[model samples]
Structures are given as structure tokens and as C-alpha cells.
Target: MATTASSAVTASLTSVTLEVADPDAAHRFYSAFGVDTRIHLRASETPSSGFRGFALALTVSGPATVDAFVDAAVAAGATVLKPAAKSMWGYGGVVQAPDGTIWKVATSAKKDNGPATREIDETVLLLGVADVKATKEFYVGQGLTVARSFGGKYTEFAAGPSSPVKLALYKHRGLAKDLGVAADGSGSHRIALGGTGSAFTDPDGFVWEA
Candidate 1:
């Protein structure tokens, strides 16, 4: 018997993130596709001597090429927050996403004696809201369980396995307002905030994580 003309349906796939105002919306869309999620804590609360900052750990081919890529990202869709500049310790620059998440792109400052190389880096995304409880519930219903709870005023939900992108909720007026900075939906830049995690603001006037 001759095989029928049953052509396989092949589609080009380019995976990109969806930036939605409501976390619940994002959760529902991804969950329907059966996507797994996981949360990763900061590499360390007390980073090593040369660990620098844990904002966004994107490893680029070289420091010079970092800014060019960041610029391209901005031109494509990302919102450029901090222009690419050589960090204090050396390496690359930090840029912000349209959703206000920082992207720290850089090359390895440590010596590479072995063939082992790093590819994908971790980036911690901050989700801000007026009410912490309400926000947490929104993520929960979407199938993302709280991986870490700060108790005081923050909780993180995992996005995917091995990805350190955190969905955090924080108080609006606690740190940003306290610093005498007005909320313009993106907060007043980023603050170390005296902790293992970095500080970030949301599109709204709410504080959370980076």
C-alpha cells in the first residue's frame, strides 16, 4: 500500500517570555502547556570576595561585546535602564528589561584553566504589588507554589528548573519611599537593601526583588 501524503507538521519555535501586568495571566498561559517551574535562592547571602553582584548573571563572550548585545536587546524590546559600563571589579554592564528586571551581562573574571565553561546565567526578576498576600495567592492559583517565604514581606515562586528567576512581592513604601524616591512604576533604580538579594521595583508603585 502506498503511504498517504501525511506530512509532519513542523513549526519554528522561538521561546521568549511574556510580560503581563497580572502574574495570574502569565501563570495560566504557561501552565496550560504543562511547563515545569522551580525557584533558586541567591547563590549566597554572603557572596564570595569576587562574586560582585547577583543582579543578572548573563555570561557574554567578552566584555566589549556585552554592551552591543544589550543595545540590540533594547532596540528589539528591552527597556534600557542602566547603560552598559565596566563594573567596578571588571567584566560588563547591567541592563533592565521592559518588565524592569536587570540583566547583568559579563565575561568571566576568574581564571579559566580547565575546558569547563559557563553558558546560561541566573537572573532574579522582581514582581511588585501593593498587597503581598493578594499577589501570592495569584501565583498559587496559577500552579506555582511558593518556594521561599521571607515572612516579613516577600515570597518567591519558581519559573522553571535551574532558572533563578524569582517572582517576589514587596511593600511599596517600605524601602523605596523610605529612601525619599518617588515611584514612577519602575522604582528608584536598584538598591542592595542590605541582604543577599538585590532590590527592584515593579511597573507599579510596589517594591519587591530583582
Candidate 2:
């Protein structure tokens, strides 16, 4: 029996929501992060009673970390909802972006020994190739910008105005050997760069952006 499209789509699932503290500031910050800041606001003003404080909530690592994040957000034009401090749950306090989004950054009390899921906050795509130099040059020629490099084995590329999209290049043979799939110059993967660009494999078994 042929597989249904819904089943296939369900097999490949990912979810992410962008929350901001101040609507205007959040829009600006996200725009700099390479996201198009054109989403229509559902609502903005604080409700008379329900869900007071902060527009959006973010789960942070801890109080200090949340504080640092708040500082960065403020520097990036976000407004503070509450200062980072100790939470009643022994974690950290919450932060509000200018858009009224709340970020809850806290430390996990116990380690999770379960399925590993991708972080929605950031998504990185890996591309395998034999020659890193040539791959980098190809992207540079195609109007993309190179940001950083992990030695000659790998290089990072810019996907946004402030954020970066990683185009990791591992040894083609190493990747092929590791993935148990031979490099046939036809296999493919899709990387949604949050509006920056998508990466795909080329006929020469190299990855390119579109």
C-alpha cells in the first residue's frame, strides 16, 4: 500500500513559536535575527485579570542566565517585564520581552533520559562533503555570506542579519559511513532557515542554499 501524504507529513514534524516582550521591539529584534517581522498582532494590551505580566513566556536555563538574556534583549530593544531573580520553584524568574512575551528560562531539576528532540529556539542543518574549501567558495559565489569556520573540516554561514545558519561540512566519506547511506549525489534534506534560506544537496553531492 502506498503511504498517505498525512502519514508522511506526520513522520517529519517540527514546531516553533516566536514570542516577544514588546510588540514593536520584538518585531525589530526578530527582524534583525532574520525573521520577517510582519506577523499580525492577535492582541496586545494586558487583560484586566487573566495571565498578568509579560506578553510571551520563554523557558530559560536559570536566574542568572535569564538576567543575561534580559540584558541582551534590552540591548536589542526589548522591554523588561520583571528582573531576573529566584522563582518559587527554585529555578529562575520569568522575563518579558517588549512584545509582552514571557520567557521562562530555568534549569531542569532532573536529567531527561528520553527521546532527543530538536530545539525550536534554533535549528541547524548539517551538510556532508569531501571538500570544505570548494563548498565554502560555492556558497560565497551564490550571494551567501560566510560567518565562521570550525577549522577546515567545517564552516558556518550567515542566514540572517544578526543570527547565523550553520552549514556544517563533514567528511563526505565520514558522513556516508556514519549515516550508513552511500553518497549517491541524489539524497536530500530540507533545512528551514526561519526565512533566511533553505539548504539542499546538489548533483555533485554538495549542499546549496535556495
Candidate 3:
């Protein structure tokens, strides 16, 4: 659905809405990060119903930063889904956020290379949508320029070079394969965002918080 307003829109996401049983508690737990978040309380949802389809990726420049960041996250109620260490991709680890969302914190230092600086870098929101083409079109229709895209597999968008975070989309099964999870994601999408786009849900159920 295109409109004159859609064409004129200049959008950037401000939050990821999550459906939770307790908004206050989830808010308290997620408040540790600077990223603004929204919570929706729904009693009908199963324990696994919310936020099972995506991962938040945080990147730093080296190992020590990754460890410290992850350590702090764990201390702030996040649980280690995967221990921090050097992986083929880089130095990083996985943690389950308080709202059941998964987070992957890593350094740019790849296992094949040597050391990089210890400075923390960027935090990116990665969404796993059921239909990449449709999802990409939805955001594009809302006036967010895609930074990069790989056929129908992935897409990234951010505000120029200064924004510390970026939004991305990927094919649902492809993302799940990397996380070693089932691809058939369901239940209350439990997430939302505010930006240029009209309110809508991608094929897999991730909702736009606006």
C-alpha cells in the first residue's frame, strides 16, 4: 500500500516492541541498554510465544570489550546462551535478553586474523521475517533507503555513518539455521517499532511498533 505520505516519509526505527507478561519487569531488565523499547502485556501467550524470531547483534572491536559487555549483560539478568569466545566469525557470545529475545555480542576480530582494538562499536537489530521480498518492500515503501541487500536473503538500513545502530531483515529459515532453532516461528510477535512506515507485520509476525 503506497501513499503520498509514504513517499514523503523519512523513517528511522526508535524501538522494538515486545509482548511480555510483565511490562514493568521487562522494562526494568531491558533498561540496561540505551536502545528504547516497548512492551505489550498479553496473558494468553505461551512462555515461548514472544520474540523467538530474531537476534540483536552488538559488535565491538576486540575481545575484552565483548567479555565485559556480555558480563554486564549477564549480571543485569541476561543469561548466557553461548559462552564468549573466539568463533570462526569473530570473538563473541550469545545471550538471551530478559524478554526472551536473543542477543549476539561480538568483536570484528575474526578467528583467522589477529587482534583488533578493544573499542566497542555498533549494535544492530536483526529481524527474521518469513518473506524477505515483501518485508523489504514494506520498509522501502515507508521511505527507508536500504544500505545493502543480498537478493532476497538480507537487507540493512541505517542513518548515514553516524547512527550507532542499524535495522536489518533476513529470510526466516536462514536466520534460524544459524541460531540452531526451528524456522516456523509463531505466537504474539511481541515486538514493535516507530519510524516512517505504516503499522504492519512482516510475514513471520514481527510487528512495527508505530
What's the TM-score of every candidate structure? 0.36, 0.33, 0.74
Local accuracy of candidate 1 as per-residue lDDT tens digits, 111-164: 333343333343344443566667666545434456566654666554454333
lDDT of 2 by residue, 1-210 (tens): 111111111111122233323456556665542233222232233222322211222333444444554565667655544455544454433443444333433434223344322222333344566576687666555445565666556665554434322334455655444333334443122112232335554434433333
| Collision pairs in model 3 | 17-191, 17-192, 18-190, 19-190, 192-209, 193-209
Ordered list by lDDT, greatest first: 3, 1, 2
lDDT of 2 at 9: 14
Identify the runs in model 1 with alpha carbons over 4 angstroms from their true place. Answer: 1-80, 83-118, 161-166, 170-182, 185-210
TM-score of 3: 0.74
- After superposing candidate 3, which stretches have Cα over 4 Å from the reference? 1-9, 31-51, 110-120, 160-164
Question: Could you tell me the lDDT of residue 12 within candidate 3?
Answer: 70
Task: Give the winner by lDDT.
Answer: 3
Highest TM-score against the true fold, candidate: 3
lDDT accuracy of residue 42 in candidate 3: 37
- Please give the CA lDDT of all the candidate structures: 0.41, 0.40, 0.66
Worst-scoring 10-residue span by lDDT in model 2? 4-13
